[model samples]
Target: MPTRALCWFRRDLRLDDHAPLSQALINHDEIHCVFVFDTTILDALPRQDRRVEFIWHAVAELKETLRQQGSDLIVEHGDPATLIPRLAHRLGAHAVYCAEDYEPAARQRDTRVAETLKQAGIAFHALKDQVIFAKDEILTAAGRPYTVFTPYKNAWLARLHPRDYATWESKTLVSRLARHDDTLVMPSLDQLGFGDTDLCTLRLPLGTSGAETLLKDFLERMDDYAQTRDFPGIKGVSYLSPHLRFGTLSIRRLVKHALEHGGDGASTWLSELIWREFYQQLLWHFPHAATTSFKPEYRDLAFENDTARFEAWREGATGYPIVDAAMRQLKRSGWMHNRLRMIVASFLVKDLLIDWRWGERHFAELLLDFDLAANNGGWQWAASTGCDAQPYFRIFNPVTQSERFDPEGHFIRRYVPELATLDKRAIHAPWKAKVLPAGFTLGRDYPFPIVDHAAQREKALALFGKREG
Candidate 1:
């Protein structure tokens, strides 16, 4: 009897460089590809979510690519824990293969799926494709996971042999993809309970082809990534976050390119890629941080959940130009600059004195590039509540950050156009301008600063001091 396998596509959407997909092609005589809409996640999302739309388009592209190679993707709707088992039993598959997911909920879902498959006498194989190193792969000499980033990065570097970054070369053997016995058509966005958003109008690329377009363009400017990545006005950054989040591109290939480049820019960019892995392992080790503060001591520190102030921050009306611009960028587009992400997050936690979880949840709903681990880790870092977080006293001065990274206010002017007429000097702190520009009323045109930075800093210190001490 010939062995048949089902390749379940989750975060790893592309066919090339996918470890589980590659392994399935070799071990089985026939392969059936699948992607689940996963109503468990989709049912709770807004009707006009960009993430659902992005996944829909990416799955469609993958299906077309598979169709060209003699097979069709089995795109299914509903809960995967129940549906995957039924599909495998119906197809009489010997085993199911998929990429590993580290999130708590995903792990639970995978466990259920595995149990179901096992009960039916079918095997389940999950391969690591998202991260270069994950879950204690880069442990300390004592065999414990490194809590700090420097040591973790150092250990990660020591363990990164050439084989670790080698391409899987999966595409060449995709001829083994099993042809679909039934003619099953993929459903449209409306069928999935999602509506069209600015994703198409924004002209963001979709699937493998889209990732290649971004990678090629980024390589031309890789040398300048160090000096330019901080500025959000121009296209200094490689707009590949969404691609990485959705796994349209291979993490192994990305790391290999950075390793080969051998420059400060590439090394810095490589560190960022490692940081993504670092956060993943962090979540895997300390799942409590997903909801509570990583440092338990910080959890007792009361965080004010100010409703009106958080709304102002969300709407980009906090009266801080840099912070407002970053929020506006996130609201208008489904993305925000990384540097601005830090700045705005600091303003929210330290200046506005709000809970980091609230900000993290808002970003979860809005950011197309949002990964639960990365988003939660970043919010905790900004709020001084996670492992390896910034010192609680070292609050970011939003005005200074704006003046330094976005000098001449190009980024601010682009996103917060109400401050466009203000000169560079006044743009950073428009309220402190010696003279207001004509018709630029402080409260009427733009609201005054929501919270005084100096006062808020003192209040934040006192709050932490009273509880943390």
Candidate 2:
């Protein structure tokens, strides 16, 4: 009759370097690991969600891993507040352990689960695992969370220690996993009310294996990351955002690898990770940023919500090839290059005079790597509505962006097939081609520019001006 403990798995999916899992193995002789599909979240998602498919595949892999260890993952599809406490009571476990989540909905869910566990006389323990430093860890001298990124990044670098990069050894404690008389059955995606998503067909190979594959591939090209990351046509960027979002890879190991072997590429990549942490902390300190701008000054900025323009943008019919290509890529794959994300977001808020929140919500629904903090921070940054944001007047010229980043138009051609035949010089602005290539018409083949970029820039400036004055 060893003391029983339930380790609740959330975003930190892997068994390695998991604080809650490690602690469970250390303290409890018999540890039962469980994952709830979380209906509260799933019910709100679209039917063909790739993110959900990714999660389903990841969970299946996790169960297989546990089975190989002579144990099994107890999978449930319901609200954790009800399911966790009920399962703990059924197992007669004394405590439940998990990693902390900072998102508003997740925070609320955890609080509810904690209260239910408390009433049931079971201890609920949560540990920091997702991030190296979180909450108020790198606050200003006056004890406030820093609004700007540079100072916060400097403090984060200064605070880094060897111990922080060390992995928590859960492999040594594998024998502690709970063995039940009856093995628990895991549910299928259909049972959870989710249909087969595109992710399944893509065969992205979820869980630890997928993370490792992407990591190894990225390491091979890491030295040239800075040179290649900006160009969407090339494999310049590491396609690890989805893995990071799902916690398939350990952040400590990523940082350690970059620091030891990555040179200048590692330096730039590490700064990007720090930016991620900064956004997470920003959300923690200012949850209001989810609904409104971070800089209160830009809250009242006017947006001319033209649904026609937004539809054009979403359908990848925007005459600006780079912006259109990025949007199209997002539609096809749940992932987008970081550079493209910035470009598309800037086009939405600055060029179209659309509200940043609208674009933010759309991305949240579509992006597999959509974390609230990063998504919101990115949208506001593009719209010049956040602290340390780009100036409102410095709107991106989509043609120039295409010329500079996708010089050969290879990326644009891949996604926007209508522009495939056009040469490099004309691909950026197909609408302005002197001779309309046979069967290529602005309204017929590819839609015309939704709104004139130059005219809209002036309109956006005036809108911000009115708000400031």
Candidate 3:
């Protein structure tokens, strides 16, 4: 057993159900907890990034929780590849442990850190903490990685045991954490070269307490999730994606609840969680999908990459009410309803014929809950270039999606307030409304549709066909 170990928190921010933290506690006599605001990643982001703000507050809360238990987090700002090994060496820790990160860059950085630690005769360990099933944990009967989701989910469900979702209760051993001076202080957001975001106004509570609050609320609404999940205007889905992304909530706790409840709502919610896991495994197995389409045949697919249309889409001036409203939601709140995400993604790829990478990168910059694997999977799915993607011919009609999912335009009105006075029918497609709302004029109050959906649908189909054929 190691005499001293450093527990490095990354994506898994909480104190509970954490394997690395628990392993450190079980194997070492003294544990030093640290979180690095990795400058390598932060240096490229805009100072006003919501993700940075969320992480800053979340880590702050984690530190406070530790302090209450006679331990404090060592918060540092530097590149993890360099800083982690140096910190471990300085502290004379026998080993360094961290939550496993599977993204390409993170994987590379972890490898470098591990090598550096090895050079100093210190061991490095990474454990599965964030996901219920990781790597090839849920493989097919043939012992191959499952590419498609339903089969993967079926295997996942079959293989899942009580042990899979068991809690680690790492905090029960919190006494083992290395004690720190009361004077030790964490850096402020300004000190980290980041500014404030609208996270508070958006009511995105930070940290473990916030995640518990969301989980409680979501359980009450879980019964309606299956029926209501696709409706943008309704409060149908659990708004816990950010918490899940940052590991504020344990996958075990969530899955155990759903499996035990055994209802359509819980079951459906579980499937969504499964979808998150599926994307993760896909990225783990096919890291190239991070930057290119999963299907190699579609890798060089021609896209117009229309700059003007993409700019309009980004600015929420697409003239398609649903797409515009969704874009507005993304810009304002750093989140878009899941249904809206699909609709807007289709509009960007099929209608504007823009490269899906553009929208994926845009979302990466804006979403508070952005996960590279999930974002890439979602964008590729919409563009019909990923595993189990939408049929190439089945392009989403933005107006119809608006009518079906947001008929009352309540969601639209909230984001596109300019369309508030228009009748619900007109709100979705103002140009086609027999009589425009009394005060509104096309191209003045709102811009005209950038492109005809039908024409663009044909163009997109032909473009993809040319490449795929």
What are the runs in model 3 whose C-alpha is more than 4 Å off?
none
* Highest lDDT model number: 1
- Can you write out model 1's per-residue Cα lDDT over 1-469, one digit (the tens) per residue? 7899999999998988889999999899889999999999999999999998988889999999888888999999999999999999998899999999999999999999999999999999989999998887988889888779998999899889999988887676777888876766999999998889999888888889999999999999998999899988778889999999999999999999999987988999998998899899999999988999998788977778799999999999999999999999999989999999999999999988899988999999999999999999899999999999987888999999999998889998998889889999999998999997998999988889999999999988888767567
Total backbone collisions, model 3: 0
Candidate 1 regions exceeding 4 Å error are none
Error of 3 at 350 (Å): 0.6
Highest TM-score model number: 1
TM-score of each: 0.99, 0.97, 0.98
lDDT (CA) per prediction: 0.92, 0.88, 0.91
For model 2, residues 207-309, the per-residue Cα lDDT tens digits are 8889999999999999998788889999888888888888888888888888887588989899999999999989988988989998888987768878988
- How many backbone clashes does every candidate have? 0, 0, 0
Q: What is the RMSD, in Å, between candidate 2 and the native fold over all Cα?
A: 1.3
- For each candidate in turn, give its C-alpha RMSD to the true structure in angstroms: 1.0, 1.3, 1.2
Of 2 and 3, the candidate ranking higher by lDDT: 3
Better of 1 and 2 by TM-score: 1
